[model samples]
Target: MPVDHYTYRVTWSPEDNEHVGLCAEFPSLSWLARSPDAALKGIRSLVAQTVADLRENNEPVPEPLAEKRYSGEFRVRIPPEQHRALAMQAAEQGVSLNRLVSMKLAA
Candidate 1:
């Protein structure tokens, strides 16, 4: 039987606008994006690279991620006044709320 595995949740604080970031609850790896879409893309790429590295070094592959499809979560808070502006940007770029906040923070 294949073993079931769990993914860690990464959280970011919206309290500080100057230095926002995504941190994995388990401290695996973190990446910065200019938008939620960018961040999502970055995370996906990171995981794929990690897998390739593991295989190249002949390291034991972790279950769950090693065999199944994976998805991650990203969250953010926005002020009521900025909702319209943010929505427009997200629609224009076709990204998520978490990504937009991350990208703005990164910039």
Candidate 2:
């Protein structure tokens, strides 16, 4: 598959004074160019070469984040005090802590 099929982002970097392109599946890699289009092209080429190198070495290539499946659940860590406050709020609203958090996140 073409590297462009993967998740890509191009953003301006004031420090570098250039556009930076990054691929979500290859977080360690980046390409900088004068223009957004050039940056994207450069990053895509880099990703393609990286994929080829991995394959040549018989190493596993990471699946694109866009192609991965999510179970609609993830864990988050909160401070004990915040956790207690949220639990009390959930109780006041007659809902489970999970439901209360879900509602807040959706909002």
Candidate 3:
């Protein structure tokens, strides 16, 4: 099931002063606990219950981020001047503009 592969994370929340568990697939839902382990468990259980409820209601569940395939292609718009500069840099580096941008984004 996609729910089993859903992206999960636990991080500290200074505002709440407790650990927070999060699911990328369901951004609106979260679990809080004193410890990271408990937080993670809580979130996982919450996700399971939520998934069950969604299924019971015949609602479409979100696709798991880990289970989704990415084409590694996307479009972005930048200022003309910045675009020209990147082109010049690409020329100087002897690489395609796409390669130059990809390298910069990776860094």
Which candidate ranks first by lDDT, i.e. highest?
3
Expressed as tens digits, the lDDT of each residue in 1-107 for candidate 3 is 84669999999999999999999999999999999999999999999999999999999888898878999999999999999999999999999999999999999
1 versus 2: better lDDT goes to: 2
Q: After best superposition, candidate 3 residue 97: deviation in angstroms?
A: 0.5
TM-score of model number 2: 0.88
* Prediction 3 global C-alpha lDDT: 0.95
Q: Estimate, for each residue in 50-92, the C-alpha lDDT of model 1 and write its tens digit.
A: 6668779998756554445556554556687798788789889
How far does residue 15 in candidate 2 sit from its true spot (Å)?
0.8
> What TM-score goes with each of the models?
0.40, 0.88, 0.94
lDDT of 1 at 58: 93
- Higher-lDDT candidate of 2 and 3: 3
Candidate 3 wrong stretches, greater than 4 Å: none
Q: Look at candidate 1 and tell me the lDDT of residue 80.
A: 78
Index of the highest-TM-score prediction: 3
- Candidate 2 Cα outliers beyond 4 Å, as residue runs: none
Q: Write the per-residue lDDT of candidate 2 for residues 33-88, one digit (tens) a residue.
A: 99999999999999999999999999998887777899999999999999999999
